[model samples]
Target: MARSKGQTALNRAQIVETGLRLLNEVGLDGLTLRRVAKELNVQAPALYWHVGNKQELLDEMATAMLREMSGGQGSDPPGSNWQELLAQAGRGLRRALLRYRDGAKVFAGTRLTDTGHAEEQEAHLRRLVAAGFSPDAAARASFIVFVFTEGFVIEQQAVHPMPGERAPGYDVTERAEALGPEFPLAAQAGADLFGDYDARFEEGLSAVIAGIGATLGPRTQS
Candidate 1:
């Protein structure tokens, strides 16, 4: 089959968008350049022209997801303090990851293909610096916050797998029963550990932010 003259030329953005949709439908393991190409009615080699390989396509998808999360502008809300800013970023990132199947796994360890996020990242570091953190400390603290959110979401997706869905073997009640009466504390802790993700994330994010502040010391007047 030949592409018609009216057909729009393929681009990186189109490929990434298609890949994300496929990710939701088939998950990270099922998503492939060939599938994306088929979705776009193009040959697999055509996708390679825009994305060198599957990993490159995944990187592009992650970048696109983050871009969408930031609404194409990564700035903290007005008057947001460093702690507030850190918490907001964590929450936002988690929401973004939850938007796709295996999102955290796909996003983790992938390099951004472009510098679009650099300015926003710089702004975050600058804000922290103004809050009295040394440049290195600011970077480290920011990374810690990010890593915590990523790790949390990875575990979250593993248990939930998808929205309104739960993987087998993770049921709190079943887990408690499986542990039997001997492991009372462990059985009782199931609800606290596995239930109420929103609350857990907020609590964990708050604790992380507090720890960062405590470890980094008092913030100077900006």
Candidate 2:
């Protein structure tokens, strides 16, 4: 059906906004152009005018999310040093990912093309370089923090086992029992191996920052 006169034509921003909402509702797998078009009351062809295909739509969705996650809102002030900067970014990334179901799953492998995202990343790297890290080390440290955050969030949001179904892999007790006395330490520790996620993330974030700090050695006079 053709849209009536005075009705708003679908645009890229509206399409992306609708796509993000659908992503949170049905996750990446269920998100499709037809679904978005239906939700927007536009024909599927209308959606193509904005986004070429499903993969292109996903790229836009991922870019929008990365822009938001990359401090586009300026929610917090810049950190004093690279360590503090990295810590803030790590926490921010995890918090942003947690906002949408399967957020990390959507973001992990996609490369962002948005200009805002590039600026945010540049700011982060500049802070690190200014804090005594060589450019190469700064880049590596940034990836380390990002990878750690993504990896941690993936496990944190792992599948929720349905009633009467087998528990997810995080259930250490099941695995420990399966191992029996042959792996005594594993049995004894049980779920303790996983530790508390919040505490573990903070500790791991600290360790990553500290490891990067160690690489700096002494701060050279600028």
What are the candidates' C-alpha RMSDs? 2.4, 4.1
After superposition, the stretches of candidate 1 with alpha carbons farther than 4 Å from their true spots are: 1-6, 72-74, 219-222
What TM-score, computed on C-alpha atoms, does each candidate reach? 0.91, 0.79
Model 2 steric clash pairs? none
Q: Which candidate is the best by TM-score?
A: 1
Write model 2 residue lDDT over 50-133, tens digit each, in one string. 788987887777788877776544733644666678888898888888777667877788766567677677877777777777
The per-residue C-alpha lDDT of model 1 at residue 154 equals 92
Quickly count the clashes in candidate 1: 0
lDDT tens digits, residues 1-222, model 1? 456678898888899888888888898889988899899988888777779999998889888888888784356778888889788889889989999999999999999888878778888889888878899999989899899999999999888878899878888999999999999999999999887889999999999999998887346634
